[model samples]
Target: MGFFEKYLTLWVALCILVGVTLGYFFPDGFQFLGQIQIAQINLPVAVLVWLMIIPMLIKIDLKALSGVSKFARGMGVTLFINWAVKPFSMALLAWFFIGYLFRPYLPQDQIESYIAGLIILAAAPCTAMVFVWSNLMDGEPHFTLSQVALNDVIMIFTFAPLVGLLLGLSSITVPWDTLFLSVIIYIVIPLVIANSWRSLVLKQKDGDEKLTDLINKITPYSLSALLLTLVLLFGFQGIQIVTKPIIILLLSIPILIQVIFNSG
Candidate 1:
């Protein structure tokens, strides 16, 4: 298929339709899949993470990263938006919309957990998928990689405290060492593997085109996995969502705004 032939939004829509239909028809099966989790990570979603991330790693130009100064502006903006601005705004919005306007509407106690989930999503440093958005918007690729790498490093020390402070959740905890390990496993390791493999196979020969072509071939599989994961995530949340539409929407407003303002 041609480049435009494969569209992510369309694919995601189909996945959602199929997932909802299957869930309605076979709630037990989908629920079982959802329940099959070793820790917080689910099996199907782990596969999606691997597939979604590895392809983007192949696109990283480790060579271009040397001139990191060239794209400092974009990098700075991304960092500021993520660290300095996004989290606080998310909390403020959640407090206002959910605490005041929508509080009386919810079942009372569940609002805290709902806000907690949004806070977790907000606190997470963007990885794996930011690459896709940057590329789509014709962003400077090496710059994006550099910023992500630096952000990953900083987040190792900052994430837990920042999240806890923002949400006012004193008991909130993250396994920092494990989070770093995840960064290594997801971003650092993939970067090293992809770049090393590329250099080995195509360095002496001018085969960059061929390497890109090969990587592009596997794109659909990764996308399919991502779509599948998205479907599963939404299906699980769908019931609660319908139950408390206004409250949930109010809680997620901050995150939605952050995504828009930053990605715009």
Candidate 2:
């Protein structure tokens, strides 16, 4: 891992602090940026998400997707946790904590929205950060790449429906059109463009070395894009966060539990 990736937690912490500081002092600036949306998706965030995801996707060998059989055990475990467990587990946790247990403490108006957000967060499989985590854990790159590709494929098809179902079960209204637009914009478009770009790079002379060099060069930019996105998100949500600081801590409980459960 690079220095930045190794200390990613520290960087994210710093970014959060900076974002909140900026948001608190410059609320109008962040609010204007937040208004840059179409189809209920922020255009700036969509662009940043692409920047954050595409570099990681470029590292994947699409041909290695067929090698899933080589790591059947690991792949099976991954699929089970990612597809069958995490979303439902997060939903249940949200309902238990956000819906009933912590209901009185949280903003009554935003309880359903919080549950829906958690559900959506959990439904989407890990992609960009999975590469960093796998590398940190000394995992097989090929297996990790293949699993990510498989997850992306399934996510494109299932994300909206899964989120919709979970939200519906939680008695939250499902914004089907916005959710579907997000899936297409965030997943499908990036996958197509990244794969095409990867294909072209592979056809060049010394393509392997060239691709490695390119990835190395662009990896920092991708990470920077992610930090920027986080800043924007925190900035946009800063007012609410400042008022209800406990909201972040409370919401994190279920996410932390879900991670520990899956990791274990």
Candidate 3:
């Protein structure tokens, strides 16, 4: 790994600290940035997401999509974990710990919201960041791309209903419109742009060379954009993180469990 990739965790930690500090000092600026949203998706973060996701997607060879079947076993495992296990298991964990065990310790009104957030977080698998993980693990690119594509399709259909079911079971209100909008904004649009750009790149005279050069040029920027996105995300949540450190820690139990469980 290169220096930036090798020390990503340190960089991210520093960015989080910087983001929180800036956010705490400039609440109005951050709030204004946060308010520039459409359909509940923040505009600046959307741009950064595009910058981060598009370059990664550019590395994908859609022609290799046909070879995805060769890695059926790996894809199947990913599907089972991401769809069948992660969300439901997270819901159960949220209910057991947040609903029952941590009830008295957490804020009364926000308890349901907290659990709802956890359910939402786990409802869909990681999309863009999976590329980074696949690289880190020396995983097959075709398998990673295909698995992500399949998960995206499944998520489009299942994410809302599954979330609604789990949240209803937990008696939490479902924000249907916002959820759908998020899928469109985050998943649908980025996929289209990435593939479109890929097609354009491949149409050039020296297609492969052009694509490689383009990817090399923009790849570094992708990580930089990711760091910026993290800053904005942390900035938006800065006050909450500061004020409700204990609640944040408690609410994170299900997420920690889910990660450990899935990674195993």
Candidate 4:
């Protein structure tokens, strides 16, 4: 692993701190950046997501996508975990930690809201970041792409109903625009651009060598964009983090448990 990858945890910690501090001191700037959104998706973060995933996507050979059928078992397991396990498990963790164990410390009125937030978070599987993670693990690129695409499709049908079921609500408002716009921005556009660029690069005389060199050159930018994204994310929540440290910490316990459990 390279230095950046080797110390990614440390770098992430530092970025969180930097983001929080900057946000607290210069709230206006971060708020301005935050407001640049459409369908509740932040444009700056969307751009960074594009930078983060495009290099990994470029490495994917769309022609090899037909071979993804060989991993049907793995895909089935992923879907099972994502749809059948994650949301309910997260709701259970939220009930334990936020709704029960830490009840005395939390505002009774907001307990339901907190649990709902965790359920919503867990119900939606990640999309763009899957590529970055798969790249870091040196995983199968085609499988990762296919898996993310499948998850997105399943999420479209299942997210609102699942969340409504877990939250005990009769009907939940699903942001249809956000869902479709996110797919277009994160998957469709990036895939098209990356494959087009890959094809163009492969037409050169020293095609393979040039492509390899180009990917190497752009990989750092991808990682850098990831770090920047972390900064922006933390920055957006800096005020709540600073003012309600204990509440934030307590809320994080269920989320942390949910992530570890689902990922495991």
Candidate 5:
């Protein structure tokens, strides 16, 4: 297993804590970085986002895309889990807990924003990172890629509808522009770049074990960039992030359940 795969949650926790610390201590620096925006996207995090995605692009073999139909079952399972099952289940959990169970514990003003964030997260399936999860589970990579690609494609169609449906319940302002930009930058561009670069390089060279070695060497660079980006995201939104406790608690249950179930 890759280093990140072996201790993924731990690394994420570390990154979150580091980001919160940085944001807390150097609040001005975080604000300065946040202000550097292009196309209305934060520039520093955008660069870090590039780092996060570029490595995944390098690993995608174009041949996998061509071979998608060969692994229909896996694709179906992925689609079912991501769309049919996960989203509804999360909605149920959020309703039961946020709207009822812990409603008394949560602040009334932030309840809508908390629910909105959860809905946003639910609508978006894991991209660039799910491959790692799939591989660790001894999944078929071709099928996994095909599955992820299908989800990405479907996301373009479903994300807005689902988010609108769920977030509408709480009456939150849906940021359509931010959502679309996120899909373009984080999903579409990275997918295109990774596939094209890997395909072109392999077509010219042998794409042999040596090339694989080269890729493995550089893979961590992109991961480092991703981790850095997450750090900055949490850092910028530090103290304000803790305002909603119930939604955080609710999110943990489903995620925790998924991790254990997937692992088994």
Candidate 6:
């Protein structure tokens, strides 16, 4: 592993502390950033996400997509876990932990909302971060890209209904704009930019060597962007995190459990 990848946990922890501290000290600045959003999607974070994923995306070979069929069984398992198991399991966890176990600790008014939020979070699988994870694990880039793309597509159709079912709502207002825009900004745009850049570089002299050099040059920036993103995220929730540490801890337990459960 590279140096940054090797100590990524430390970097993430430091970033979170810095973000919270900065947010607490300079609330106005972070608030200004927080308000720079469209359809509730933060633009600056989107840009950071682009930076984090584009280098990884650049390494993908579009021709490899044709061979994705070879991973059918693996893909099937991923799809089943994502669509079938994850959301429902999270809903159950939320109910058991939030609605029942931790009910006395949480505000009565926000219990349902908390449950709903967890369900929504579980329903929408990670997209851009998958690249970072795949990179860290030395995962197959082609499979990672294809799986993420497929999940994005499935999320569009299933997200609202799954949330509604879990939340006991007959209908839910899906954030169509946020969903579509996120896909465009995070996936479609990055993929296009990466592949176009890849094609251009490969047409040059000593193409493969040049491409490796370019990716190596930019890899640090990708990881840096990830750290910045973490800072921004923690900054956004700094006050809340500080004031409601217990609540945050309680909420996080299920999320942590869910991640471990799903991974296992």
The estimated TM-scores of all candidates read 0.82, 0.79, 0.86, 0.98, 0.77, 0.98
Task: Provide the lDDT at 108 for model 6.
Answer: 97
lDDT of each: 0.71, 0.81, 0.81, 0.92, 0.69, 0.93
Q: Give the TM-score of candidate 5.
A: 0.77
Considering TM-score, which of the candidate structures 1 and 3 is the better prediction for this target? 3
Model 4 bad stretches (over 4 Å) = none
Candidate 6's displacement at residue 161, Å, is 1.4
In candidate 4, the residue pairs with backbone N, CA or C atoms under 3 Å apart (3 or more residues apart, or in different chains) clash, namely none
Name the runs in model 2 displaced over 4 angstroms.
108-113, 126-176
Worst 10 residues of 6 by lDDT: 132-141
Model 1, poorest ten-residue lDDT window? Answer: 38-47
lDDT of 1 by residue, 1-264 (tens): 445435767877887766666666667777888886644556666556667656666776777778989778877887888888777777776777666777887668887776766666776777877765565454666777788888888787788888888777676668765676667656776677767766665765657887877677876666666777778877776555555667666666766776787667
Listed per model in order, the count of residue pairs whose N, CA or C atoms clash below 3 Å is: 0, 0, 0, 0, 1, 0
Q: Report clash pairs, candidate 1.
A: none
**lDDT by residue for model 2 (96-167), tens:** 999999999998999999998899989878665676456446566668767776787787678767887877
Tens-place lDDT digits, model 3, residues 98-171: 99999999989988888988988999677767765665555676677678777877887787778889888644
Q: Per-residue lDDT for 59-93 in model 6, tens only?
A: 99998788889999999999999999999999999
Q: Which model, 1 or 2, shows the larger TM-score?
A: 1
Clashing pairs in 5: 57-194
User: In the order shown, what is each candidate's alpha-carbon RMSD?
Assistant: 3.1, 3.4, 2.6, 1.0, 3.7, 0.9
Model 4, span 39-146: residue lDDT tens:
999999999999999989999989999999999999999999998899889989999999899999998899999989989999999998889988888889899999
Scored by Cα lDDT, where does model 1 land? 0.71
By lDDT, the better pick of 1 and 2 is: 2
